[model samples]
Target: MEEETDTEEEKLLKRQRRERKELQAKIQGMKNAVPKNDKKRRKQLTEDVARLEAEMDERHQQEVEHLRLEISKQVEVESLANGIGKLECEDGEKTAQHSRPTKAQKRRDKKAALEKEREERIAEAEIENLSGVRHLENQKLGHVLAGRGLQIKQIPSDGHCMYRAVEDQLKERGSMLTLAQLRSQTAQYMQGHVDDFLPFLITPSTGDVYTPEEFEKYCDDIVNTPAWGGQLELRALSHILQTPIEVVQADSSPIVVGEEYSSKPVILVYMRHAYGLGEHYNSVEELKDRTTEIG
Candidate 1:
């Protein structure tokens, strides 16, 4: 009986897995058929995919419940076959003859424990996969840029990476500005335009708006310390230099800042895992010839 029950459970699980694989393949095909630029179609595709995934999850839950019920019925039958019964005492109270857990109960407990362990392993793997995904994205960005006759000129992994990349691009345009000078100018520009940048400056730890004094200190750090630069600083730099800046990434189209300033924008590549030291930026330069070897 136990062997028959095991065979049935295995068959059901195998069939469900096969169905899930086919559904996933169909969804992927649907996504591949849609063009990336068609925002409406892509949005609709996203909704459809989400709906399908939810349905699959619900179906999987139902199958699990069904299997649990089947196991419970089998356990009850096995217990009855083992002569499980109750005895009446002198006080007319009934007491179970068996004091220890039955074999079927132990099997059910073991299965539940194994399922919980598998879930925990999956959760841990997902956390590790975040970094893995970023690494893969950086590689994809390299391939995309290579196809466009451009290559990433790696910048140092220091906190001044953004400024350094900007400085490198500016040099190609005949603007000889030191990293320190660029930092100072960016800091000064933000300090002068507090109303523009302050609204976005929320304290990460407290999740509150920064006081005027805090904002001032932030600007000061941009100049005097190795503070990291972000989108706000990029905007400020674009305006200060009076040149449009383009940030390219793997997952999306290039983002143009200060587009009003110039038609020819300075290109910078944003990377998540290129340097292994957190978010970094690299300068983009055109290849000299079509025959140039690319890695």
Candidate 2:
């Protein structure tokens, strides 16, 4: 009967601990979900969370008492069984000696102790640490962008069942912006500079050179990203950011370099004005430094 009571108490304590652990995990999840800005809502959630934790601790304390009772019951059972002759050896020898714990068992116990201490230390540190609180910076940044009306509802930019994002700024604020305006805005947005990236202007027409920055941005954003092939030796003539002046054919055609020609590499800048300026630039650096204002 005592053994049975001990078993029941042990089981009950185990169940109580399990329930407390689950409550702890749940409270943690709710804390994560509640935003810092929503003070009233956060306060309510926090109070409820606190209540849950208090209840869990209360239950756990009760479980500890139950566990103590269980141990006592087990001890009593062992004493009663020892009182019975059936438990004793018929041919009694000297009591077997208890060997010291193995090195592995000792190490495992030490590891467990250390882990418990570390967890306690972390919890204490969390109490002292204000910066451990996550303000959800990424989501805040997203909201900032959204507030600026940068969010354009994705719509199909093509016949395929796919949606392409047109910047809200582009559709509304920049609706009347020219190529120059577009280029300047992108440069300002990205690098706080007044440069432009015009990727479709120069080709076998202007006979101008390319800049390294222009080449990289074109590859990163357009050629590698959009995967537009066949247009080899793409050059930028513009000094601005996004709206780079690129070298396209006379009719703004995509030029296939090797298949189009071999030895005589005829490079063209898109604008006739750019071709007019070609005689002005002696080298690549000169072209990059040259900012033209067409009369």
Residue 253 alpha-carbon offset, candidate 1, angstroms: 2.1
The reply for model 1, stretches above 4 Å from the true place, is: 1-135, 288-295
Residue lDDT tens for model 1, 239-283: 998889998988778777798995578889987555321456899
Candidate 2: segments with Cα more than 4 A from true spot: 1-21, 86-295
Query: After TM-score superposition, what is the CA distance of residue 97 in candidate 2 from its true location, in Å?
Result: 26
Best-fitting candidate, scored by TM-score: 1
> Could you tell me the TM-score of candidate 2?
0.25
Report the number of the highest-lDDT candidate.
1
Q: How do all models score by TM-score?
A: 0.54, 0.25
